[model samples]
Target chain A: MLIHFHVNGKACAVDAAPDEKLLDTLREKLQITSVKRGCENGDCGACTVLLDGRPVASCIFLTVKARNHSIQTIEAFGEPGHLHPLQEKFRAHGAFQCGFCAPGVTLSAISLLNQNPTPTEEEVRRAISGNLCRCSGYVQIVEAIMDYVEERRAAREEL
Target chain B: MAAMIYPHDSCGVSGATSVFLKVDSDGSAVLYSGLSDVGQGSKTALSQLAAEILGIPMDKITFIAGDTHTTPYDEGTGASRTTFFCGHCVKEACEKARTQLFEAAGRMLGVPSPEKFYIQDGVIYLKTFPECHVSVAEAAHASERIYGHPILASATFSSFSTPADPETGHALMFERHTFGTQIAEVDVDIDTGEIDVLKLAAVHSCGTVINPNLVEGQIYGGVHMGLGQALMEEMLEREDGSVVSNTFSEYHILTAADMPGVMLSGMVERPVEDGPFGAGGMSEGAPSPTAPAVGNAVADALGIRFTSLPLTPERILTALKAKQSSQRS
Candidate 1:
């Protein structure tokens, strides 16, 4: 089967097996290394990606089902020289240590801020609850998200 | 609380060195080592040490590590010894390279004593006559031209070895000891037998914080692992010894929602005698005290002691029922 979708603001087309996971297509076919394969099941959010502006685990999601949907990976953010605000904040706050789970966590946070721009600390915790980071407990990660939100608000107020 | 000391066994023989320094004609240097990062930030810490000792900017140093074909033998990265043991090797290697650089700079500057010269920001200069100087690139080029090889130096380090006593099986086991104390506050529901950790506070000493951010990250991760052991993590096996609970859903780890509301941590920066830059190993020792602290807190909350791991709801209820039945009897 041939499937066409938009990835990271670019149109992409790939031939897919009916049972092939989106994670495989993105990593193997398209060469997007950010969509890591942590757990094949939906338990670990390491393979999370945005489908139609909402976060979903790509490892469990079939590529055939993603036709016409907009898929977003960490690459949608900034690259090496140009970093997204979330990535910048994450680095500044030391949110990630091993950085294996950073892509999924960052996307989940993007989805969170997209829905609720100003969330409480508890809300922030719940937003990224699905992603798992073995290194750097969720303390700094949550703080980074909260700090980004606060900084955005302050910037908006100045405007 | 029972007093216990668990000997750290993994990092005993761990070692790494800048086996070679290939100084390009441009003065840039590439350092080779076998220490693998594995996300513990050993690369950054070791690189910082090298940069400090070499008197070169961090950008000027390229660290090559974790490949057997390119790097030397390392005991591997575990036991929290990368920064302590491997760092010592890096320090020594950089010092050796520094000496070579000074020697070359002395001959070029016509100085009899190389000690009278110093290197800063990759530039070697006379301390007495600051006007006369040679860049590290120039020094390397001059040394290679005169000595017929690139400027290279290497060093290996091993901590003091204490032979174990055969009778009691105890020796001066570890090269250095890292100490930590953690306090956990939990809320236990009497009716539901649920335990919710409200806060966690950890005060630890790993000796002379190399990177404060990285150290704090290790502490946070350690507490999370300890929470898993204390509350909900378990590995189950059947009669034939086949494993169950193999997946993340079955074998649960702490999530953001499960995290405590407040995490308070502090460090005691007491430098160890033989450690590199007076630093000791930390990550492995961070989780040691957490389970006991949380268990004690739960006992304080419920007025009963539960001896098994995970402290599951069913276990808590079973312990409560046994207590009640005993009181009735």
Candidate 2:
């Protein structure tokens, strides 16, 4: 089946099999490989992406279900040369290690920040709980989000 | 020093892990590396190393990571190698670029080399003279104009071992050992045998923390995983080894309401010299310490060293009854 959705701020079209999982459509059809396949049963959020600005596990969603929505993957954030502040903040805080689950986790945090620019530590924890990271204990990832929230708040206060 | 492995050269000092450093015209720096930042703080730690060496504010530096196809071949960001191995490759990449920066500033300043120069606020300055200085972006552009290449550097690190293993597969027993200890405190209901982890203390040695807040995040997250391992989280099988607990309803993980108390501690002794700022290791410290800690803590609370995991209430009660029967003799 043919589907159309806004991806990374651009209009694109792709042919996806009706039974194809969203993860396969994104990785194989669209060729966006940042969202990794950790547990395809939707237990791990490694394949999380923004479906109309809400974070959902791509592995569980049917490719056809995404026909009319806007989806955002990690690539939408920024390229290697030009990075989103959160990506930079994530780096400054060392929120990544072996990075396999990075894209989904980053996108999840970004989705939360977009809705609530200022999130508490617990909020950050709850938001990212589904994304499993077996490295670095999730310390830096949460800290980076917390720091990003504070910085944005400070900037807003100054304004 | 184990070289960089699959993603971040995971072997020795030099590996195929790629750390890309790019400084903008405005003194803002962005680092793009293949390192996975799946919660280990590798992005932040590597950025700190680059920002520290480049003399830029941590906020000014950004990281682009973990897009497997686009990002460098990092070892998939596991086994605590990001900071140790990837950090070195990044450090070297930055150092290699720093040389060109200093060299360019030297010719303009009439110095033999900018060896002792420092990069600050995007400005390159002589450590000794302190008077002669140049903005890194401008100097880099100037260097490009003069030497025909921008101030850019790349490092690809791989774990320094052969993929082919001797029969034992022990040659890579531990590229580097990340040690840790966990202490668990549980409340075992004498009747129900249900164990509640009242509190937990986890001491880790993943090396120097690139970010304390981030490390704390790791602790709590790990504690939750530990909590799941202790009170719940198990796979069920039948007599023929057929799967039984095939769903979340059957095989459960601990939830937030469980309110498992946690204390994060560590023994970083020292960062491996080649590793990121002497930091080494990661979440592998979580599981090992957790089960034992919970088991010991439950014994402390109810006075029984239950031998198996997931000391369910039925098992605990049966064991308690058995212990009492044994004591009666």
Candidate 3:
């Protein structure tokens, strides 16, 4: 089956195998390198990406189901000189090491923030519960996202 | 960028994925580096070192660490090697530039040994002459012209390993190894036999603290893995060594609900007589204390020593039954 969708705001088309995981299409065919390989069974959210602006583990998603949805990979988040505030906050707050799980973490945090612009620390942890970080523990990652939420909330109040 | 000063507006937006630095004809310097963003804050830490050495603001540096073929060779950034090793090389490269600042100052001053010369705020000055303040790029260019050369120094650093004695496991390489302690607190449900990690505490000494936030994260990650090994995750096999419990339904990791409050504590970062930044590796701690910490915690909670990992409900009940029989005997 041929499927067309918006990936990172760009139109994308791919031939789909019904049972193929969305992760295979993005990493193997499209060559978006940010979504990493950890546990293929989706236990580790290392392969998380945004599906229609919500975070989902690409490893478990069926490629055929992505027909008209919006997908976002780490490559689309931002680049040098133009970074998403979450990435900046993560860096400033020291939210990563080895960085194997960074892309997934970044996506998961963004997903949480998208659903609830103002989230408590516990909420943030629950939102990112599916993902596993092999380094930096989860303390800093949680701190980084919490910092972003607080700062964003303050900025929103100013507006 | 290496010394990126992220505006609050771009809080979640990560861009400019690369960096580098350059020196102008004047006394200004710039840095370029790929922002691998190792989460140890290599870019910020490296820029701090450059600014410390080159007498420039950390923001004056730029970096590019993302596109591997374009920027430089990084082995995907693992094993806690970024700070002690990579930062050492970056510092040395800046020193090479510092050397030129001295050489230029030396030729004009007719002074000896600019190696000891100091620069502050992009102004080269001799401690011997407090009145003389000169721009760095000016001095560098002048020295290049007078000495008939251009000085652009680049460096790549490789991390080394230890020479440990096979018998005793004692050795020396990059300073010394780090030691960490993990304590687990758990409670097993009598009916369900589900073990719960009530609390986890870890104390680690991985040399100097480059970033406390990063260190805390490392501790949390380690304890979480320990939690998984204790109650949920297992690489199980059949009696014939065939695979079972192969999927997420069986092989489990800790969820937010399964975790307890983590307490991070420890110290061990003062530099020995040797070492890059007096820092050691952190990779080992994530897996080392995990099993033991949870094992001891399970014992504390259940009053039974676990002979094997992953104290699943069935296993706990079995052990409990055995304990009951022994008590009756």
> Which model, 2 or 3, shows the larger lDDT?
2
List model 2 lDDT by residue over A1-159, tens digit each: 788878777887888888889899888878889879877888768899999999999988998898878999998887798989999998887667667878988898999989988888778878887777655456567768889899999999998
- Over 4 Å off in model 3, which ranges? A10-21, A27-31, A74-77, A155-159, B1-47, B57-100, B128-131, B149-177, B231-233, B238-250, B255-258, B265-269, B277-287
Cα miss at B151, model 2 (Å)? 1.3
The backbone clash count of each candidate, in order, is 0, 65, 50
Lowest-sum lDDT 10-residue window in model 1 chain B: B1-10
In terms of docking quality, model 2 is incorrect
**Residue A50 CA error for candidate 3 (Å)?**
3.1
Off by over 4 Å in 2: A1-159, B1-16, B24-30, B156-172, B239-242, B262-269, B300-303
DockQ for all models: 0.83, 0.18, 0.36
Winning model by DockQ:
1
True contacts kept of each: 0.72, 0.28, 0.57
Worst 10 residues of 2 chain B by lDDT: B1-10
Off by over 4 Å in 1: B1-19, B146-149, B165-170
The docking quality of candidate 2, as DockQ, is 0.18
lDDT of 3 by residue, A22-89 (tens): 99999988998788877888788899999988888898899989999999988778777898989999
| Residue A159 accuracy (lDDT) in model 1 | 100
| Order of models, best lDDT first | 1, 2, 3
Per-residue lDDT tens digits for candidate 1, residues A1-159, read 999999988998899999999999999999998999998889989999999879999999999999998999988877898999989999998889889899999999999899999999999899899998888779999989999999999998999
Q: Evaluate model 3: give its TM-score.
A: 0.74
Full-model lDDT for every candidate: 0.84, 0.72, 0.69
